[model samples]
Target: MTGGPATPPTPRPPLGPELEVRRLGRFDYARARDLQQELVAQRAAGEVCDQLLLLEHPEVVTLGRRTPEGAADGLDLPLVEIERGGEATWHGPGQLVAYPLFLLPLGRRDLHAYLRDLEEVVLRTLADLGVEGERREGLTGVWAGGHKVCSIGVAVRRWVTWHGLALNVSNDLAGFERFRPCGLEPGVMGRVADLAEVPADDPLLEAHLERHVRGVFGHR
Candidate 1:
């Protein structure tokens, strides 16, 4: 889903620099998107602080501004046009979706640099678990052996980031088969458990993911 064009950065909030993280469980994609829109609106209105929201969505496919037509594959998976920048991708119970609402200083409106920082967070998390991951040129996700383990699509309004990244933790790969992931071939999709040899049903995997995410985005 593609959001509108970047807006001019507003003055920073008075709160000392900090990152706010919230964990939401099993939210619907539409609802989550709505929440993001509301947050962006609130930020524009100067009614809220910079924050990051993490959550999982029920099975849903999202299409971005550049979403490929052939990638839909005639499937009926619910599609929501989002403000984030990217192509089509899947989200389900086992996937982790992070939406960061941050106010970038006026001169710091660099989308490419922000994307690289977000990718680094995921790469560092995967590396903590012994999964070697890297980024491919022209792509915005982390990959393990040519297969994408994480997908990132984001939107910024007035220099405040909204929609964020999604990492496949233990979701069913069958749903992913319904679309060309991030407009890439089916062979490019991957999951955390598939790479780590951990059981998809294991709660420990989620715990570890949460820990790593906290470490990566924690207040310093």
Candidate 2:
């Protein structure tokens, strides 16, 4: 069964203002999670404003709250169990990952709205790249045509958010072959590389996305 109980949104604690943006160029999966925990605590303690971590992680498969019954039965690559609100998804090179450890807006901690806002960042980002990104109603991530170009899964603590999105910019997407992505069957995914204009490589791509997210979420 899917994890996560229906919890009411709480008012955001009065903390330091302004969302801090950090780009970790290239990092491993475990390291990213470690930093998220540290930052989450800081946000909860009012020692820091909201933080947005933009980086790319090495090949890894992450399980979300609704992961299928036997999804993790077998896997050769690294598998991580997270508190996010989705099914299984993968992360690796060429995928832009954003971890927004944000203090939820006061009285606006509605999870569904927050999710749509996250998709807005990517949808706008894709539009800037000359690609048509659309959202499939009843589904979370941004889709171009019918293919999913982005995947979003998030977890919250103390009314603060962690874990964000993974956009397929230039990766081979081999990591997705492991399971039914977001509970969907295989071969339904799309990559930015498939577009005529490939996004800037690595560190550059991270910065490009960072701008759009900040703008969408009011950090700009």
Candidate 3:
């Protein structure tokens, strides 16, 4: 008897440049920012491939380009002023932060498109974990169950991108109460663990994220 029609081979994700994925557990915010700067320079010089640094930070509040002066004046958390495009935001132990040090080619250099691709990567990863994520109109993050679950802020230098999105895994949401995050009310922040059972440092979640990044950003 003839066998049933064979299934088509799984189509591979489209490839662009190579990406090196690194996992740095509980890194300091300042150090991480410095590292991104160093990598950006190297990537721009054609001395390194694309890089995706995934990690968590201790309790900290960061001010972006849109943050007004003194926006974080009273926050007890460590405050950092950064060059990324966004407002004030928080990062802590239970959050997963990703910094993509990529030297964008001519085709992928559109800042708006890059932001959307980052959102798409998060949406796909959340779907894999059984959570539905959507983008709000005029907002640049992933929300679920009517609350913001991801915050994205990025900067590009010499066409190289750095500083990226933060996903709340099992992080302490209470920290958000001390200050406005992403220019939204503190109550707007949400955690993935609230909707599903996943650790902040889950390896499987990181793997899913890597796959999504590769697919969405066209990195091999």
lDDT of 1 by residue, 1-220 (tens): 2212122234322222565566777887888888888888887677886677878888888888888666676878787766677888888887878787877665456677667667777777777668988877767888886678888988888878888888887778788786687878877788887777654454425455545545544433
Global CA lDDT computed for model 3: 0.83
lDDT of 2 by residue, 71-100 (tens): 967888889988888999988887888898
- The best-first sequence of candidates by TM-score reads 3, 2, 1
TM-score between candidate 1 and the true structure: 0.83
Off by over 4 Å in 3: 1-15, 199-204
- Model 2, TM vs. native: 0.88
lDDT of each candidate versus the true structure: 0.72, 0.78, 0.83
Judge candidate 1 at residue 77 and give its lDDT.
77
| Candidate 3 least-lDDT 10 residues | 1-10
Model 2 scores a C-alpha lDDT of: 0.78
Which regions of candidate 2 fall more than 4 Å away from where they truly are?
Answer: 1-17, 199-204
lDDT of 1 at 202: 44
| Deviation in Å, model 1, residue 108 alpha carbon | 2.5
Task: Report the error of model 2 at residue 214, Å.
Answer: 2.0
lDDT string for model 3 (1-220, tens) is: 0111112123333336699988998999999999999999999998989999999998889999999777778777788889999999999987889999888776566677777778888889889879998877678888998899999999999999999999988888998997788888999999888887774456436777888999877786
TM-score of each: 0.83, 0.88, 0.90
Looking at model 2, residue 5 earns an lDDT score of 17
